[model samples]
Target: MYLSTRIDKALFPTAALFFVYFLVMVWVNNSYAYFLHEYMGAAQKNVDFEFVSYLAILAAYCSFLCSSKIRTPGDLVVVLLILVLVPHALVLNGANSFAPEASPFSGVPLAVLLGVSLVGLSNKIHFYERDSGEDGRRYIVLLASINIAVLIFIVLKSLGHFSLDFSGQYIRRALARDVFAAGSPSGYIASIGTQAFFPVLFAWGVYKKSSFYFFLGLLNVLVLWGAFGQKYPFFVLVLIYLLMMYFRRHGQIKTAWLLFFAIGFLLLGVVEHEITDYSYINDYFVRRAFVVPSSLLGVADLFASNNVNNGYSDTLIGVLLGSERSDPLSFQMGVSIFNNPDLNANVNFLAISYLQLKYLGVLFEASFVGGVVVLLNYLYACRGSFLAIPVALLFATKILEQSLPTVMLGSGVSFMLLFLVLIAAPPQRRATGSPQQ
Candidate 1:
């Protein structure tokens, strides 16, 4: 049953308070252990400034989310970020492998916070859902044709015989390695299309009780999620599905569903480790998958090293403008390559923010990101824009978790192009001031 009291409204504020409590406790005990402090230097100013900046971004995001009445995908995005970040903050065991005095959070916390909050604002329009009238024999043939075609292509490409490693390890470290070579056109198609709202459309099919669409959608999610070997996005997809189901039906985010999802996630992790080895799980899951805080710290160190490029990296903007294109990881992590080849190359979007503009520039980029989302809400609005939610969610993830500039330059910009595919008129056409159809 839908509760009259919206618990989600409290989520942002509550999370903010949770972090505050942790901070207070850490300070009081004189044992504040966060890897960010370790990497940015053990000095008080490094951690203090970074923590203050983080608090400001959190306040801004919570303010925006709390202002809105209905639940949006931003709610889940914010929570997922906290889940990724806070635990990393709490656990600190060793000295940083990178710089001991690098304060990355001072520049980046806002990037992620506002990046996600913008997704919520960008989807203020209602979902423009329509009834798909009948599932005739022709409909079955149409769905099956594309579904089978895509699935077969994916299966063949993944096989050992094909020898095409689209497995995302290329962006990990050095690019010169033989394993880092590029893949076929179909590989690029699958990678780019995966982050769009393909699964949401399929889920709509499942909601319509089309078994063909359901299985196709399910396999699409599996392959896309497994491509990276990180399960965070996999479960994030599930969370998206749950939110879509709830919002489409106008219901509360159930406690039971969250519990079930958490348990299932834990079970999957355990099962994988049990089948494999702890070394594999720790290296991939703990170290690489949870690389944000440490990677951000390293980027902060890069800033301190005075390795700033004179101009914008010239990659993301070039790609976005149709001039030059490159992979997000390689392009963003170019500076860090010489410092340490094996260093985490997935330095996140903030690295681009820093490389382009350095410290104060991070703020400009964060504001630019947040403002762009708000502008997107304005540009893409419709009377009932169903497609906006999942697409915005994808965009938010790209900005927050991936390289910010490259995404804005590459797949992120391409997502907006969907308007041409999905809309017959300009977004302004269906707006309220315009004549209603």
Candidate 2:
């Protein structure tokens, strides 16, 4: 019976879903590679076909592991599989031009292995579950109000510099940097508001079927985009809404649909690029989102080999350890690799960990991240809260460009975890609402 159950779980809908997802990902990967080589003249070298086949086999096995473990749309393993591991797999598939000198064999497989291990190990180690029984709605509303107030103050403070013109986004982004410099109160507030408070409020609104809170959350997203000139909030808000609606209707998260949407959007961008001779979507969404983060694994690995490891000096733990400081890691990477001092070549956490302590750092970071995933999954399982989806999604995206410590603390995920804990309702509430209602 145990063996039968394992086979059933591994081969049925879950495995089939990921199989389709993987196929779409491969198409997306090949399409992007062709775009880079043909249109951009990047002269990207394709890895051995045998090597690509090997990576595909590995990815298939990892997908099986992930399929067996995924319990919800909000699962950390889901994000790791889709956002982290898929990109790395694609990188090995003739997409390594971002670091020509760096070995494609190194850094990426380690990251993939760690990701698969996390998927396998998740829910294996159990944690104590507790519910506060507090009024989740009340606390969520209070938090939203406070974040809204803070956002208003930020906008008022920068009223003179504010410009909503999309074309002037770069200038406004620079202004935002000056206004909300790192470690400043405004910076922290913006992170918390955007990453935690607003997302939760928006999700809660969806749950309660409250149009007021729903549109209010969207209005805040616009305010944030106008004030900070950051475009992620708009995209993330839309994604959260869609995921929430899907979950509500299906009563389960379907990984295949997510992949279908991703592939659809990607192909749309590619078609637009082909027709108009424009590459903004290709550059920003395709290259920046997937290719760069994956290629940075090799770049970070190569950089770490020749230089002194950061010894956690780039994080809060480094400050506590009194480690000596230099230019930020992203800036250093930007200057060294891209020859651009102004660029911030931020990368995924695995690469950042490798930069800090090489292979051992990767292991430690993976373990830490896996533990956090388990904790978040525990909370979600106990409460079955839709709000966890957005928070987890935010953390997943942040990790694509930030270090683990920065994603957890600076990006306000730790605070969001606390918020999840505070707002966790009884398991009984999970079945209270129908999707149609």
Candidate 3:
């Protein structure tokens, strides 16, 4: 019975639905002007009408076989109604709303409903582990080999012929720009800070243990604050916490002296003068002190525009795609999703999340087709790091961006494709290497 049960695919229908949604989304994108002006825009009469239609359609077509059974049919109906209605209300009324043009609650509400329904279905469809055999070992070896090759290339580049300017002048200019308000100080700091972030992330991946992830996460936050000295650190801190929790679940790490360091660093920033720049260290902090306020202000300005612009536009996405760039916060967010070879910029996970919402309209994308794409991305990519990528994406989306199919496909498609191989590969049984936990 167990074997027979396991033989049935858990998410075949969900997978199919997601592919169809993806195709539809692509079609919609190509013909966006029509749908946006005709159906969605025109449906704005009586604000609640759009939501009502969505609920009615979901009820009419979707089967509730995946949802939980309640004590009575009436209770079941009530649960279903709440699952559908509550998210809609929250989205329309809650902080999630961005543009006045689109119903304020629309995106969030749909996100909640879709999330609930999918979760219910996932619960019904238990994801069991299969014996991957020698193929699994081979996959891990292949992954590790690829990582090693990349690392070797970096090492060779750094040690063999690399002659980077390694200039602190950029930092000085950034500070002057802030002091004079000539350009965005936050942008400079964020740009430099983002340059620093990859090392920290790579450290976490190599460490591959929970404690290392925690330590690296805290380290990244501290460095971000020390270097940038603004609200931008908050995103990195949040991401670190998420990574910490994720690793902790795997028993990869424990809260230890690392957490202590983070707390101490944060405190130092609040009280100690010029702590963020650490100019005292070698004039770096002193220089950053001049730039910190401007950089911080720029980050604040971007958020303030949420009220002014009504919705995020191409500006933010362009930043990610390296077509246009902004101050540090925007640069970091943009760099995270799309790797800019021209700038020698790598992807930053935290930045990717923020841009998703900033450019894509978060709740709307997540609750519907976008959510499934993320799920499939998980199934296909980041095999060894399954929950991490999507969780990071969702986290980024929640605070900074929204999920858009085209955005995901256009910029991140290749990386996502590579990640799928990782997920399909099996875990190592011998567990050859361990971090310094």
* CA-lDDT, candidates in order: 0.44, 0.63, 0.33
* Models ranked on TM-score: 2, 1, 3
lDDT of 3 by residue, 1-437 (tens): 01112222323443333223322322222222112322211111222555445534443223232222221111122233332223222222221112223332233333334444443333232222322333233343343344344333333322322222234435533443343231344333333223233333433443345354345445444433333233344544554455445544553322222233333433343344344533131223311221221122223223434423223344455546555443333444234322332222111222222334532433343344334434443342223443333333333332222223323432233343344445465543433343111
| Worst 10-residue lDDT window, candidate 3 | 286-295
RMSD of 3: 16.6
User: TM-score for every candidate vs. truth?
Assistant: 0.59, 0.83, 0.34
What residue pairs clash in candidate 2, if any at all? none
Worst 10 residues of 2 by lDDT: 1-10
Question: Which digits, one per residue and each the tens of the lDDT, describe model 1 over residues 160-216?
Answer: 322224465343212212221334456444444544434544545544556666566
Off by over 4 Å in 1: 1-17, 20-70, 73-151, 161-187, 202-210, 224-233, 249-293, 314-344, 359-368, 375-381, 408-413, 424-437
In model 2, what lDDT does residue 281 have? 68
Candidate closest to the true structure, highest lDDT: 2
* Candidate 2 lDDT (Cα, 0 to 1): 0.63
Off by over 4 Å in 2: 1-5, 8-48, 68-70, 73-77, 101-105, 123-135, 270-284, 383-386, 425-437
Could you give candidate 2's per-residue lDDT for residues 47-136 as a string of tens digits?
Answer: 467645655665465455454433443354454555455555343333455444444356544654564465445534433333335446
Error of 2 at 121 (Å): 2.4
